[model samples]
Target: MKTYETLVAEALTVVPEILPWDLQSRLEQAPAPLLLDVREPEEYAAMHIPGSLHAPRGILEAAAQWGFEETLPELVRARDSEVVVICRSGRRSALAGRTLVEMGFKQVQSLKMGVRGWNDDGGALEDADGNEVDPELADEYFRARVRPEQMGP
Candidate 1:
């Protein structure tokens, strides 16, 4: 079986692009790209980049197909729409980015380091209610909840 690093590395190779935290901040301005957070709902609620749309990795394809409330069907319909996929760390987003590209999204990209990287780079994050999420608190939560194996190599 492939290790997580191997899988992520392979996915990254084929993904169209990667948006670093600094670049993502710039994109958050006018004509913002679609920021899709692929973490679970609970994780997203705990903290996420403001304005990001939530669609867990598992249901991403289905959500796109059936048109859920948060589904960006219009954006997805436009093959070249700038869509950025993100997860708790970069691994899952890389895979998700590959999936989007395979699904015909020409401008799909993954957040280079996910939310953790964003926080490390001083990017702002918010809870589901739009309130700012304290960085330290968020870090503590992640440390407590994330298993070492999940972090990969």
Candidate 2:
């Protein structure tokens, strides 16, 4: 069976990517890219890129269009705008970006290395409280703590 890495790799072939520093610069320009954080609610509530719209990976398709309960007006309107998809790691965003492309979104890209790399590269992150997360604290949060049982065969 194909692994998660295999899927992400396939998506990466089609999804454009931007590094954290480049993203920071792009954010300063006119018509800043629409940032989409596709992690679960709890993960997003913990911390995310400021002004990012949270549409979990599970509901992305719905959120991208109009008339659905999950529809995000901004996303629907941004079909022609630059959009950046982000996740804890870069993997999910790659797949999500590909989905956006398939759905006819123009100028879609993934945040390479994701929020973890952003924090590592001194990019700012705000908690649910809107307080900037300390780099050290973000580091703690990003540590991979997979239990033995979570490993696949």
Model 1 regions lying over 4 Å from their true place: 16-19, 66-71, 144-153
Which residue pairs show backbone clashes in model 1?
Answer: none
- List, residue by residue over 1-153, the lDDT tens digit for candidate 1: 998789899898887445565555657587677888999999999899887888888888865654566565754564577788888877899998888888877777788868887887778899988999999987876664667899779
Q: On residues 33-105, what C-alpha lDDT tens digit does candidate 2 reach at each position?
A: 9999999998898999999999999999999999999999999999999999999989999999999999999
For model 2, what is the alpha-carbon lDDT of residue 38? 97
In model 1, what is the error at residue 140, expressed in angstroms? 1.4
What is the TM-score of each predicted model, taking all chains together? 0.83, 0.96
Worst 10 residues of 1 by lDDT: 16-25
Off by over 4 Å in 2: none
Cα RMSD (Å) per model? 3.2, 1.0
* lDDT of every predicted structure (CA atoms): 0.79, 0.94
Instruction: Give residue 113's error in model 1 in angstroms.
Output: 1.5
Q: What is the TM-score (0 to 1) of candidate 2? A: 0.96
